[model samples]
Target chain A: MKKSIILFIALLGLASVAYANESQIWGEMRIQNILGYGQEESLKLGVLFTMLQSKYFAWVFLGVLLGVPLVFFLHYKIVGPKVFPHSHKKHYAFNLFHRTVHQIAAVSFLVLLPTGFIIVFGDFFGGGTLVRMAKNLHGLFTIPFAIVVIPMALMWLKEALFNLEDVKWFMILGGYLSKEKQIINATQFNAGQKMWYWVAILGGITMILSGAFMFFLDFKMEMLHNITGLSQIDLLRVAAILHNVMGFAVVALFITHVYMSMFAIKGAVYSIITGYVEEEEVKILHNAWYKKLKEKGKF
Target chain B: MSNEMSRMKFFCDDHRCIECFACSVACAEAHELPTGISRRKVITLFDGIEGKEVSTSIACMHCTDAPCEQVCPVDCFYIREDGIVLHDKEKCIGCGYCLYACPFGAPQFPRDGAFGAKGAMDKCTMCAGGPLETNSEKERHLYGQNRIAEGKVPMCAAVCSTNALLVGDAESVSTIYRKRVAGRGKGA
Candidate 1:
């Protein structure tokens, strides 16, 4: 009996030691603890911040900030009377669908960029009031931006697929930077633009899949959820990284594509915005389609 | 509440715990842990003779003063009345500081992300409720184990087939442990 009591005291001493050195378990349990706290406050704060950074607002700002001068320069310097001296006319099929896609893409990209930046940089910069504000807006705008881009991807799926023509155009560097007036039978969209389209579609899908997995953490397919074993917050943390990386990559691609379409290519802007291009310019750039349309008296 | 202590503690008889993973399975089931995350793990530390191996089951000790609570940026970890250190999953950022802070490497992260986002910090919580209101679905989904609410002993202690793992009030548990150690001619 005395021996049993001594053993009991030793066990009690060990238990006390475990309690005293609780910090040893610090590495094991911190993330789940933080997640529990975030669910109470940060998540709601982040969603709210996401709304203020909506693509619609960002696009409108971009239009006022950058589009005004771009439109003026393109209209006056490139496609103005001094350049080609022809009146503009609209192409029904190309004008409507192309313009709509442009607008949608512009808005989606604008919101996606800044919101994405915040998600990536918020931790590095410290989640201050401004960072918190930006996070909320980033989360909010992702919803509509994702919605518009999905259908846009489906709508343009046909032209974006890889083909032999794309290879030739890629080999020739899309004939934009070079002074070569290389005439090739081109389709509705050029090779460079087609490449950009594919990048945007594929990258956007990656972001959406990763993002959706994060957003509906509680509602995902049981098998997948069971396999992941990640908390919703953990998935969001990962999605935030992917979304930011893809968002910036897409934005960079957009900047180059936009610069090419509006500035580098002389008649491209007019064709997209005013829905028209001079018949001669079309014949030079899109020889095969131009010939087909002219034979039908459609150009 | 601060003065209250846990009724269950895990004690591994160093002689009997042969480094097998049976305790891990019992823990996973009791907690309903997803496949990739194990709350309890047996770690073997072999030293001395070539033929001899020493292994111990390392898990959350349900510390009375848990360090996980201190290092958490969001303050999500909480010590239950029973001294189990549980945490909320909603606030986790997957930053992985807890892994560094743990001495026994009890915290395990799933290698799921491309850039190595530490999947939520999952560790033994002594089968106690987390930050969620006890017995809620949110608690079940996030924290996994909730044995304390069910009025049962932790599964790791109960299912240890070798009777190597023991759980109960700290005092009673120590008494049993002391007797076993002395009977085996071991020192404190």
Candidate 2:
């Protein structure tokens, strides 16, 4: 009875949180007027209605706030060192590509995250000396950040493709959450990790595209004019929403990925940082690849 | 007050508009609007429709109840006592809600700011002063054609060669319209 009551209370709390982030009343009225009525009415109802639909940033924030601690607790308590102990075998060859990609991703994401946040919250927190400084920094760093993100996306392109093994790995929860060690013969990156990689790349591309369009509104791009069929003002409004959504999505993914790597899987952090792992841990986690590398005398 | 309201409205005669874009160019020139930003445009609907193609000069309606004023996040838009809806360029963040809400595609933005930054919105303000102090140079440069204060009609209405465009109070303008419709009756 107590457990059921606790669950009920938790559900209610979640329901309230969901309701709190609802779009405004006027936005609802506008949507109804648009979908049910004619274009004339919809145009009269105006762009404010569309702005309400672009509040994905709120969801991204909630996902991170809840997902981070939950992942950490699950990793430490439920699936700690008992499942996967620290490895010391130093399998450097297998991790070389992974390590390089991880570093680039980390750096690019670090820059993107803060710049994104500043852009969103600039209205409230703007005009301060510190915020002005941060804005300058954000503008400066975004150039290199954009440069690295493109290559990072291309590097992970092959692994993100959907394959039969990826499907099976997904069906079995990537054999990470489930205690079935036999199902662990998955591909280079597990299904869950691959999903994260794909989202990062796709979401990153959206941010870059929208951000670029917004930054160059002054240029006479006849193509853009024809495509949106909107005045320059409308284009900027659309860009703002896209940039905000992608920014939040990237932040949420980063938090979850970090928690899983650093605290969830024992010794997962060490491999990336040191480029080495114990022989026993490798044999347990990645036996097939480990044995092949060893036979080739590449490790 | 009726005379004041007369300066806030615009009308185009469908019969006289030749779809030549002369009025559109005149509006832009009157405002000194920057390149690629047009406060007024000619929308030619139904091209080659066997005498049914309609060309209308579109700009701000200066609506009795403007939606742009209601939806602006910064409260940048204001309706003058004469009912002309004008916005403060300095306060505008280039969000474009006004462009979306406007029924006539009156609001325009410069496309040359850093990062495609939307410059402040420019639109037909019924030839009235914006939120700036009355008759200020800043107001003249940003809004353009402040004919309301000069006791004259708007440039678009004045420059209309065929006298197709009219600007005045709702009742008087509608009366003129009814007279025109009545004059064309009985196939005479």
Candidate 3:
């Protein structure tokens, strides 16, 4: 009888323990190990994010900030502005459709760059309501900025393609630094402009891909990473680096492009604004394009 | 002075944990933490599988190389001489970058405001509060009890009935854990 009682108690204890474990599991269903997120991904994200918070990024930001004006100053001091001889004859430099697209692209870029910079350097300004506003605006502008770049790239595709003449133009530094009017044979867009177009197109695509992933983080990208033989963390690190590096490089190129169009070349800004350039200006600057226009009797 | 230089650590022996969740409750009650935030949580993996059920209580590991400190955008986190990682609440912008950076998901943000507004981060301080006057009411209110300042164990560690959670200098904690595992006929 004593042996039987001991056995019954042991069986009862085991049953109660199992039942308690089941209840415990049901109670803590929401709690998870590492909260169901990959620890390595967080570590990599932390490391990169810390890097952005460091003084290195600040110094690089300062360099890019000050470098643009210095380049412009040197150009102004050494080369002086390009002042074409006056001509009353007007030529259709840009059509209404192209000019409209250019204006929209310029406006969107103008909004995106400042807001983007504010978010990037939020610590210096002491992040608060303004930084939050900048972040939202940056996200909002990305849509229009991304949408406009694709159509604009397609529209200017033919003229933006590089040819043998572009090599000559690049060798002479696009004739901007020359004392005399050294004409390098070029079409509607110069070699420098062609390079800028390509950078903008490629960089825009990169930004969109990375930004979309960051925005919609719920995507099952880990499965894709598994198939590709890369850990999720590795993929995230690569994406983050590409997005940031490409974004900064394209921003630098943009500043130079703006300075060239607005300050260095006198008629360039007016041409974009009014959709017209002087006939003599085109003949002197874009000789190849002018000859082609004449041959077609479109001038 | 040597104790100050000593690296502090926390260890949870799964063999001893009963999954009672008293550690989590004790921590919350001791800290007076808001309802939505939990400083410690007990997670049971593969429960009700006869021999496979494993329970462990987790909080901030106070990592030797902490990811939270690395990822804070405002440079809010600071590590003490004893390796206790803490952060300044005033500087924290509630951007949730630290949440992404932490491997243990130790960082907690209170969703008190509308549209799911995230309040500043709150985490396990190892019973050490923020950069405030130690044991003051302000410190207690913002960061919870500073048991470490009083030369006492953390409340969660203190109230653990099973003694699963152990906290101390690295050498001592490891020694205790090593002996316990040995008693159970397991490799340390």
Q: List lDDT for all candidates, in order.
A: 0.58, 0.60, 0.72
How far residue A45's Cα lies from its native spot in candidate 2, in Å, is: 12
Every candidate's DockQ is 0.03, 0.08, 0.30
Q: What DockQ does candidate 3 score?
A: 0.30
Ranking by TM-score: 3, 2, 1
**Best by the TM-score measure:** 3
Q: Give one digit per residue, the lDDT tens place, for model 2 in A225-299.
A: 598665344454566567666666677777778766776565577767777765555565545555676787854
Name the TM-score of candidate 2. Answer: 0.63
After the best TM-score superposition of candidate 1, give how far the Cα of residue A204 lies from its true spot, in angstroms. Answer: 1.3
By the lDDT metric, which is better: model 1 or model 3? 3
Candidate 3 — which residues are off by over 4 angstroms? A1-55, A85-87, A216-219, A222-235, A278-281, B1-4, B18-57, B94-123, B127-161, B185-187
Docking class of predicted structure 3 = acceptable
**For residues A1-299, what per-residue lDDT tens digits would candidate 3 score against the true structure?**
34543654464355344433432111353343244334553434445554664435545656786887798899888988877754666778688878887888788789878876776676666765666566556666776666566668878999999999889888888888875776657898889989999888888778866654443322233355578654333344445556667777778888988888777877678888898876766777788998898898865
Model 1, A27-131: lDDT tens digits are 233434333332654443223223323223234444543554565456445444223335644343355766786677677667766755554443344433444
Cα error, residue B113 of model 2, in Å, equals 2.4
Q: Sort every candidate by lDDT, greatest first.
A: 3, 2, 1
